[model samples]
Target: MHHLTGHRNIVELRGAYEDRHSVNLIMELCEGGELFDRIIARGHYSERAAALLCREMVSVVHSCHSMGVFHRDLKPENFLFLNNKEDSPLKATDFGLSVFFKHGEQFKDLVGSAYYVAPEVLKRHYGAEADIWSAGIILYILLSGVPPFWADHPWIREDGEAPDKPLDITVISRMKQFRAMNKLKKVALKIVAENLSEEEITGLKEMFRSLDTDNSGTITLEELRSGLPKLGTKISESEITQLMEAADVDGNGTIDYSEFVSATMHMNRLEKEDHILKAFEYFDKDHSGYITVDELEEALKKYDMGDDKTIKDIIAEVDTDHDGRINYQEFVAMMRNNSPEIVPNRRRMF
Candidate 1:
């Protein structure tokens, strides 16, 4: 964090202190709020505005890499305006997932948030190029209000030549469904995390315990808001609510042990053959080598979100063949291209 000083876009880490169980840093404050909120409030985000935002975002990446730091997580939530002024600088914050690296060095850990993670990173071997890819994703979302990839569905061809037709769903509802898809990825990845290295996930147990400071076995919104500062995240109250709701998989308005694991784990860990195979096995309950709609519904039922319509929609999104079931090939295709809800109606603007 101290290494990011003297950069205009980065959130400066001024000082640090340690209390019994945690270390805290005094960070630069950006009271203007998150990048997404500003875009949504502006109503009409013009290409000119998007270009300026993209430049600032990209500049932050360049600065980080030039300083030998790899900011593994680059999402809209991490960018904030210095103030409510129209010309406030867009500051890049959140270095919790960052690491100092030498030139040509490769990192193997599954870091970064959903949608913004790069393909090579998912393969568990990637260099500074991955941060550039993440910045590109932010640029895409800056213009479209959504990322350009989602589950590698046919319509989401990585090339800039996908179909231009809009979905029958309205944009507002589409946003909601897109958020739903993001949560779905969390649930799916949680299953894979269970079989991963215990040491890799053991930290999460301590994380949950700290957030559940009351030892109540669940993390409330207040606890989450308080605990976030310890982890170097400075989020607005509204953003905290959104995050709490997203991570509260049980809809109980609190994060449980399992929900925290799901919400905190990286969604791109599906690149490993064994990891994906384990997830596929969970869906293919009958060992039929295919994931039927019934099986999907049953799998999602444990989370109480598996209505018939959702099952149909999920299959429609990933089932490339005319067949109703998702075969191993289709499943692999979807997992390999893990990403955000996309609308390919426009030409590549980023």
Candidate 2:
């Protein structure tokens, strides 16, 4: 299971005991009871804390994906708190729904807590991405104190219907029947609204490109060292080197794109997109998807945004047909091709 998970966020399975009658597994015990407990106790968490939690969860999911292990059961209750505090780092636990992939084989077993299941999983033809959907639910809960997809009065129907009947049945029905009681119905509904979006993908791609140097579509030791200047992530050089070595698979002194993507793939696109879009919207005063020169100038005044010429240059470069205006398609094309050589950095790293 450890070899299959490949993600550091999972609790390490040191050993297991099994007999004809019973079985036990020795696993890392996190002091924190569970993320669900913290959320219920506190009601809500700050945006920064929410962001951090999402970051950690996404990272774990990404690792599971690369190694072909899918944590089909991911929810606040399954998230083990490493320290007995709300701020403690989280470790995803409960792999009862976990599966190891075979070539061309996709998951069909309907397993996991219902509230956090992915929509695709409901149809029964799903893969590792389903885990991503569950992580998104946790993110919504941490940030908004509620899940995105649920119905009103989840516990009992005023109309004398079954206890399991809820308006948010579409997603919940796919959870292998893990629906919560009435009080927690709204929590699931909240998750549906916080689903990841395309804009979030764009922002993450930029982050990935900035960290991945040498353009081998991956981040190796040398690339990570080079990217430190950009991330401003403070840590010992030795530690960073260790992380790089741990991720390096070919012993070619570099980490490939797969390794880097796998490491960060679990990041919640919604959280990233929401913040980035606000900034973009503020700069685009005219309500247009693209910012104009005048609007850009005003935004620069407020943001102390880098050199004006850099923005103009970007707009022009993306206007491949030289039409003097950048559209969503052009902007996305440029964003996807993030290498400096492919998309020159006209401004300073900052």
Best model number under TM-score: 1
> What is the per-residue lDDT of model 2 for residues 231-318, given as tens digits with 9 covering 90 to 100?
3335467766765654443345665544333233322322243433444455456777765767655644442333567557655665
Candidate 2 TM-score versus the reference: 0.44
Q: Which regions of candidate 2 deviate over 4 angstroms?
A: 4-7, 102-104, 152-350
What is the Å distance of residue 331 in model 2 from its true position? 52
TM-score of each: 0.46, 0.44
Reference-based lDDT, residue 33, model 1: 92
User: Under the 3 Å rule for N, CA and C atoms, how many clashes does model 1 have?
Assistant: 0
Model 1 lDDT at residue 174? 20
Name the top lDDT candidate. Answer: 1
In the range 1-350, model 1's lDDT, one tens digit per residue, is: 77778888888888999999999899998899988666443322458888888888888988888889998988878899999988889999988888999999998999997678998998999998898998888887666554565443555544642232222112222223224553345556657766777644434565566568788999899987776665343447786677777777667788777667655543334445678778888888888878898888888888787888778777878788758998676776665553223312223222
Which 10 consecutive residues of model 2 have the lowest summed lDDT? 180-189
